[model samples]
Target chain A: MTDAIPEFKKTEATKVGITGSALTAGIGSATRKEIAIILAVAVLVIGGLEFVLWAYDVPQYILPRPSLIAAALVKEFPLLLPHLGYSMVSLLSGFTIGAVTGMVMAAIVTQYPLVEKVVTPYILVLVTTPMLALVPLLILRFGFGYTPRIIAVALAVGPMVMINAATGFRRTDSAKLALARSYGASTLQIFWKIRAPMALPMILVGLMIGSIFGLLTTVGAEMVGGGFGLGNRLTTYSSMINMPEFFAVILLLSIIGILIYVIFFLIGKKWASWET
Target chain B: MVVKLAVRNAGKRYDDLEALKGCSFDVADKTIVSIVGPSGCGKTTLLWSMSGLHSLTSGQVDLDGERITAPRPEIGLVFQEANLLPWRNLMDNILFPFEVKHQTPDMAWITHLMDRVGLTGFEKRMPRELSGGMQQRGAIVRALSLRPQVLLMDEPFGALDAFTREEMNRLVEEIWLETKTTIVFITHSIEEAIFLSDRVIVLTKRPGRVHADYPVNLPRPRSLETMAGREVFDLMNKIKADIYGMSSMRPRSAAE
Candidate 1:
């Protein structure tokens, strides 16, 4: 008699009946389909552009075809390698210094309100005025070398990182902090264990934004004064009317920017998965 | 019986507003005491003051005769929500108290507590992956991990469904028996207060004060059947009458 009612079976049926179809739509397969669509659209667009340029008989110096740009990339790869090396070195070193210092400053300022009040106005000034505008002045003092470019890159990245990181550090849930205090957790312990981990997602966002800004400033500063770098190469190629090689350097910079974005995206996905 | 905890003339004023006014109570060792009050009656404020999370504007809370001005290691608090660290797994969240204290946790005891709370299989699960009831269960276990002499729970089961809340109430009774920890449980439900406590403290609204302290003489190890008995019903009604009587006397009809 009890079994005839089928109470448990009824609940089981209702549970699957509502969400079964939607849940079965696999995320992996959906993502793969999306990637395939994107690849097909890219092929069509680039291939169409190549056909139009070829049909019109555009001169290589005036507007290189997609094929010529590809060829220039392969042919000039050996010559462009040293400049790529120089740009990456300054970019990475400056970014490392900027990001680390920004995080440290954010932690300190947030912990000490008096210090925050004193330092915030200067940070705002750095944020509003383009650090690239200071590149010529930096070059005047430090000469046309890696030193000026690195300084400009670091200055450009620092304020961006500091602002985001500071906001993240302050965004910790008050309830969690109260819980920590109830356990008699010391200030340092609370900062490191509770506050820092909670701030990581925001900190990652800052690093992503800072890295892009750092790359831009590195290129711009190199264009202003430096004799060696991809930015310097861009200036040289354009001055000599070497259009294919100029476009090739621009292509390399685009690839580097995309790589930075993808690295941070993967890091956020792996480390901050619990946020969702 | 010895006084394990005491709240002496506790009062709190938020500038012009008085939250709690001269509210006082005492809990004997190894006993369950529940406090029930009307809305805005400062039940939570009293609980927070007792936990030493904050101080009363006047008066003090003492545990084992030592005045508590700030949070101490001897008392453990279960918040209104599970309040689990989202980034941490259940096991890591439970071990947080030990991390704060710089003390090594006993894995065997932790596993045992998890078993007792029916969270034995969920140690590695993240907080977001667990159900609300499961998260609350994990919180109860975390509070018990430190082996505190007194456990102060602020509406720990308030967020759960009726069935899960009852299950948590049962778990609380069972844990109290095994560990013999003095507990101060606060709630809005009169039946819940009488069902689980040896003594139920009732507080009035606004400038909250202890209106009555009623003792329950129900037999040990109470079940759902025990709660449905005539004696339990009478006790619940008596407390309800006291609360309703106070409501009628209010000059303004402030709905709860």
Candidate 2:
């Protein structure tokens, strides 16, 4: 048994080294292959759709060809660019306000029983009631400008953020809390050090979901009311029987949504790397 | 040496269950005391009371003649589970107590403690990446970073394998000898209690009270070889008999 000890240690060390090297190489190759596959699939699917549209001779007025949408986008480049910038500003401002307000409200509600009891029912109602139905009422109250649209987006996004953040904060481990207490940590110290870091990944989850909801609400409100945004352009072009321009605006909105999701996803992965 | 801790008639009750009744003990400065009892005998409850993590229904705990109403930095606690923050690496975890108290930890002492605990090369790894024994070592280091006058450990190695548990016990004894910190370690193993302690306090079953207080006469700087002697086995059998409430069934060889 004594003679076996050093041999055992040597074998174990070798095993660990081999496994570590294999894991690093495996992850590197897997990510590269995944990216290549995604790019190839996107090209094939988009190219197939374009080919089918060409073969069928689909009318550009009804469902604009991809080429026609691209041309329309270039033709209205100057006008689309400024309006796009304006819509983005509204979306970002509304999203930020809604996310921050929701997170603070969640922290308060979870920390205080009285606050939770008072606000829980109201939150449930807000989540269930469609913000789209409230846009017209808000427009009548706040007028046909940016105020109604921004408020609509905030109202639509707030509940998701509140619910998700509250759940995350509540899921902190009791043992960690006890450890902090034993170390003579005060209430605020425990919250900021243990609870906050533990809840971060979930909080980011809430922000991503809320941002998407905010963008959708912004588009919906702009579509229903007067505006110079992409959604408004879609409505105006469709009403004027300009299908290519309408399709072009819709495509732009989809791209914006994708970009927002990608940005939040990268942030979450970077900051919350400790979370499983 | 001064008396660092005194528990006077420390009793605790939970709604309908009596956890501890009339339990009292005194720990002198720079000594190691171990509390041993069967499961559910309030060994943990007593430790928590000493740490001021739980309030007693009756009686008082005094630390260096001052009444303890809440947990303070002067007393450190290590739980059965490692309970290290998963987000923190080993060094940050060791520095947690200092961070919470808004004091800068002594880097030289921390490095020395890490070396003493056989964790010299694991300063940058996350808790999840560590083995159970390594995590417990980190927990011990974290507890000691504050330079606490008294350390309360509740089965800190109960979850580790026997080999690792023995290694940890030796390491703890070495640390205690070097630092001279008063320690109250709770465990269920009689051999463990006798091996590492200056005195062992045994508690009776539910609604626990002190059953026996045996001052271990073993030599200082104890090693694994100390546990192999006949005297150690004799004491282990004696404590075992007492714990099992089988005083009549004491081993024939142990009678001498």
Per-model lDDT: 0.86, 0.82
Chain A TM-score of candidate 1 vs. true chain A? 0.87
Deviation in angstroms for B11 in model 2?
Answer: 0.9
What TM-score do all the candidates reach, one by one?
A: 0.89, 0.87
Give the Cα error of residue A110 in candidate 2, in Å: 1.3
Tens digit per residue, CA lDDT, model 2, B160-181: 8888787778778889988999
Q: What clash pairs does model 2 have?
A: none
In terms of TM-score, the best-performing candidate is 1
* TM-score for predicted model 1 compared with the true structure: 0.89
Cα displacement (angstroms), candidate 1, residue A51, comes to: 2.3
Worst 10 residues of 2 chain A by lDDT: A1-10
Model 2 misses residue B95 by how many Å? 2.3
Estimate, for each residue in A1-276, the C-alpha lDDT of model 1 and write its tens digit. 001111223343333332232212122223678999989999988898888889998887888888888889999999999999999988998999999999999998998889999999999998788888999999899999899989988898888899989987988788899999999888898998889988887888889899999999999988998799999999999999999899999999999998898787667655655565
Residue B115 lDDT (model 2): 83
Model 2 misses residue A89 by how many Å? 2.4
What lDDT is reached at residue A212 by model 2? 86
For all candidates, state DockQ relative to the true structure: 0.44, 0.39
* Residue runs of model 2 more than 4 Å from their true location after superposition: A1-30, A65-67, B246-256
Provide the lowest-lDDT 10-residue window in model 1 chain B: B247-256
